[model samples]
Target: MIFMEDVQQSQATIAMPIDRVGVKGLRLPIVVRDRESGVQHTVAQVSMSVDLPAEFKGTHMSRFVEALEHWEGTLDYHSFLTLLDDIVDRLQARSAHLRFVFPYFLRRRSPVSKAGGMMDYTCRVDGYLKDGKLTFTLGADVPVMTVCPCSKAISDEGAHSQRAEVRILTRFEGFLWLEDLIEIGERAGSCQVYSLLKREDEKYVTETAFAHPTFVEDVVREAAKGLDEHPKVTWYKVEVESFESIHNHSAFAVIESDG
Candidate 1:
C-alpha cells in the first residue's frame, strides 16, 4: 500500500478549536485503591478528552486507551492527575479532561438479622488539568430508606416511606474515597439499606425509618453539614431525591458550599 499522509495532522482551514474532544462511554476494567479495603477492581465507563488546538483537525482517539494502559492496573489520586497531565502533554494541548464512572461496592451487614452482602454505589472520579494545576472531583450516589415527616405526622396507621438517594460531590485537595461519601450519605437518610435483609432486618429498618421521619430537604441539609465539616473537602455539594411512595412526583433538595 502507498504511504498515506497523516490526515488528522493536516491543518484545518477553519481553525476552530474544540473545548473537549475524545473518547466517551468506554468500558474498561480498572484497579483503584480503597482506603479501608486496600484494593478494588471494577469496570468503569470512562470519558477522556483533550482540548483541540485550532491548527489540529482531530485528536488521536486511540491514544486515550493507550494512556489508560499506562496506568498498569492501578489508579489513585496522584496517578489519576498524572494521567490527565500526561495526556495534555502528549496531545500538546492546553488542557485535558478525564472522567470515570463506576459502581463501587461496599460491604454491609443487616441491622438486625446480621446477614451481610455487598451493595454497589454509583461513584465518579473526574479530573481536569491545565497550566500545571489539576482540579479533581469525587462523587457518589448512596441509596437509603426515607420516611416523610409530614406523612408520619398526618397518618394514623403509618407513614409513607420510599427509597431515596443522596448524591454528594466534593473537590478535595487530598485523598478521598467513595466509601467515605457513602457513610455521610447513609447517615443523612432516615435509615440505611441493605442488599440482603432477613425478615428481622426488614422489620428493624422499617421501624427505624419511621422513627427518624426525615424529608428530602432534611436529608440534603444533613449531608451538607457533614461535608462542610470534612477537613479534606475543599468544596462540596449535596443533593437528595426521594421517590415519594404516595405521590406521583419525587421530592428533592440541594445544598452546596465552598469549604
Candidate 2:
C-alpha cells in the first residue's frame, strides 16, 4: 500500500467562515434584579450571536454556552454588560449580540379593597456591541383596561370597555427598569387590569375606566410623552392595541422617534 496517511493529510481543506453563529431560544432559569424589589426568579429565552471574520473558519460554539453558564442566575444591567464584553472577547469578533425575553411579576394592590396580588408582565432585553460601542434596549408588554372615549361620549348609558396591550421599546444608556414601562402603560390606559379582583374592585375599576376613557391615539401619545421624559432613554417606540368590545377587530396605533 502507498502512504495512505500522507494522501489523507494532503486532501484536507479548511472550512469557510460563518457570518453569524450562536445559540437561540435557550431556556434558562435566572434570577434578575428588580428595581422595586431585590430579586426575582424568571425563565429567560436567550439568543446569542457573533460575526465571524473572513479569515476564521468557524467560531467555537461551545464557548458561547460556557459564557452563559457562568452568569446564568445573576443578571442585572452591569452583569449584562459584562456578559457581552466577555462574549466579544472570547469569540474574538468585531460584533456580538444577545437577546433575552422573560416574564416578570409585580405585586399590585386593588384600588378599592387594597388586596395585593402578583401580576405577570412580559419583558425583553437586548444588548449588542459593534466596533467597540455597545447599545442596550429594554422592553415590556403591559395589559390594561381601555374604554373608548368616542364610545363614552356618543353612547347614552354604558360605554364599551376592552382589554388593551401596550408595548414599549426603548434604547437606554443607563439602567432602565421594566417596571417603569409597565407603570407608564398602565397609567396611560383607562384603568389598570388585574388578575384577581373582588366585587368592590370590579365596580371600582368600571367606574375608574368610565371616568378616564382614552382612544388608541391617546394611549400611544401619552406613553410617548412618558418615554420622552425618561433621561436614560435615547430612542423609543410606543404601540397600543385595543380589543374592541363592540367590534370584532382591534384598534391599533404606533408612535416612534421618526414619527
Candidate 3:
C-alpha cells in the first residue's frame, strides 16, 4: 500500500527558520544511575527540541520519541551528551536541547531514632548541544528546617521555626554526586529536615534548629559559599525560600554566579 503525501517534509512557503520546535511533558519511565541506589527507576518529564530550518515545513515530531526509545543504558551526563548528538544528527538540526524533570528519592536515617525513610527532592537535568559542544546543568530543591534568628533571640522560652526549601543550580566539569549537593543544602540550613522523627528525634531536631538559627539570606549565602569551594562547579545559583511559621507570607533570598 502506498502512503499519503508527505506534508511535514514538504517545502514551506514562508521560508522562515524556527529556533526551537519539538515535544514537552513527555513522561517516561527511565533508569538513572544513583550513587547510593546504584540504579534508580523513576518517571521523568522530558522536553526535547531542535532547530527547524526554513527549507522544511515542519520536523518529524515522532523522531524525538524514537530517540528516547533507541537510547539504551543508564541515563547520565555522558549518556545525555550522546543522546543529544543522536538527536541533532537524526533531526538534521544545528542545535538540540533536552531536559528531564523528576522527583528523586533518597533514603535518610533519623538523627536520634535512626529510623529509615525515603525523602523526595525536586530535581532537573538539562543539556544543550551546538557546534560540536555540549553544556549541562544540574539542579535540586532541598527541604530543611529553618529557625528564625530574631525569634530565637527575642523569645524567652521557645523560638519560631519553619520548613525552608534551598534550591541550587550548577554547571560542573568533572563528577559531582547528587548526595554532595543535597548535603550542602542540608548543612546550610538551620538543620536538616527528616521524614521520620520519633520523640527523641523530634527533640533533637527542635533543639538543633533552635540553636542553629538562620535567615533566608543566610541560607543562600551559606550555600553559595559551599558551592564556591567546590572545584568542579564552574557556575552556580542558590536560592532559599522559607515558609514562615507565624506569618502568612514567605521569605526568600538568592545568590548567583556566572563563573
Candidate 4:
C-alpha cells in the first residue's frame, strides 16, 4: 500500500491562530446524577472545541469524538472537568471548551388533587479549561404563572394572568445541583406551573397567583434573593420574562451579582 499524505498536519500559510475549532450540534447519550433518583438518562446536544495553534494547519476534528467516547461514568462537575482536560491533552492544545444542552425531567404533583406527571426543563452546562484551570456554569429555564399587579389593582372583576419563564445561570464554589436553581426560579413567580392539574388544583393556582400578583421585576428580585442566601453560589445571573396577557409586547427584568 502507498503512504497517504497527512494534509491536516501540514503547516498553515496564514499566521493567525484559531481560538476554537471542533464539532458542534452533535447528539449523544448522557447520564446525569439525579436529585431524587440515582441517575437519569438523557440525550444532549454536545459541542466540543479546542484552540488551534498558528503553526498547525488544522486540528484533528475526529479526536473530539474519540475523547468523548473514551469518557465513562456519570456526568457531573468533576467528570465534566476530566472531559475538558482530556480534550486539551488529546488535541495538544492550551485551552478547551465543552457545552451540553438537554431537557431535564422532574416529576410534579398537583397542589390539591395530587395528580402526578413529568415536567421538562431546558438546561445547559458549559465547561471551559484554560492554563490548567477549569470553570463551569449551570443554567436552567423554568416556566411558571404570574398575575399582573397593575391589572389586579385596577380591575374590578378579575385580574389578568399569564405564563412567565425565569432563567438562571450560576457558578458555584462547591457541589450544586440543577434542582436548587430550579426551585429558586419556581418560587420567584406568583405560582409554579404543573403538568397535570385537576379542577381544584387549577382553582388553587389561579387564586394563589391573583392574591400574590407580581411584575417581572419582582420575579427577578426574588430569584436573586434566593441565590444570595445560598452558600455555594459565588456568582449568579437571574432573568425573568413575562408573556403579557393584555399587551402586545412582553415584559422582562434581569439581575446579576457583582461576583
Residue range 157-218, candidate 2, lDDT tens digits: 88889999999999877677788899999988989999778899999999999999999998
Better of 1 and 4 by lDDT: 4
Extract clashing residue pairs from model 2.
Answer: none
Residues 1-259, candidate 1, lDDT per residue (tens digit)? 9998877888987899899999998888988878777999999999999988889888888788888877665667888878887788677788999999998987889988788899999999888888888888999999989988888888799988999999999998767777789999999999999999999998999989898999898999999988887788889988899998888999899998956
Residues 1-259, candidate 4: write the lDDT tens digits.
9999877778999967999999999888899878999789999999999998888898999889999999884689888999999999999999999999999999999999999999999999999999999889999999989998888888898988999999999999878888999999999999999999999999999999998999999999999999999999999998999999889999999999999
Model 4 alpha-carbon drift over 4 Å, by segment: none
Model 2: what TM-score?
Answer: 0.85
TM-score, one value per model: 0.94, 0.85, 0.92, 0.94
lDDT computed for candidate 3: 0.90
Error of 2 at 210 (Å): 1.5
Per-residue C-alpha lDDT of model 3 across residues 193-235, encoded as one tens digit per residue: 9888899999999999888999999999999999999889999
Candidate that would win on lDDT: 4
List RMSD in Å for every model shown. 1.6, 4.6, 1.9, 1.6
lDDT of 3 at 128: 92
Candidate 3 minimal-lDDT segment of 10 residues: 69-78
Error of 4 at 229 (Å): 0.3
Clashes (candidate 3): 0
Q: Please, what is the whole-model Cα lDDT of each candidate in the order they appear?
A: 0.88, 0.85, 0.90, 0.92
Looking at model 3, the pairs that clash are none
Deviation of model 2 at 232, angstroms: 3.1
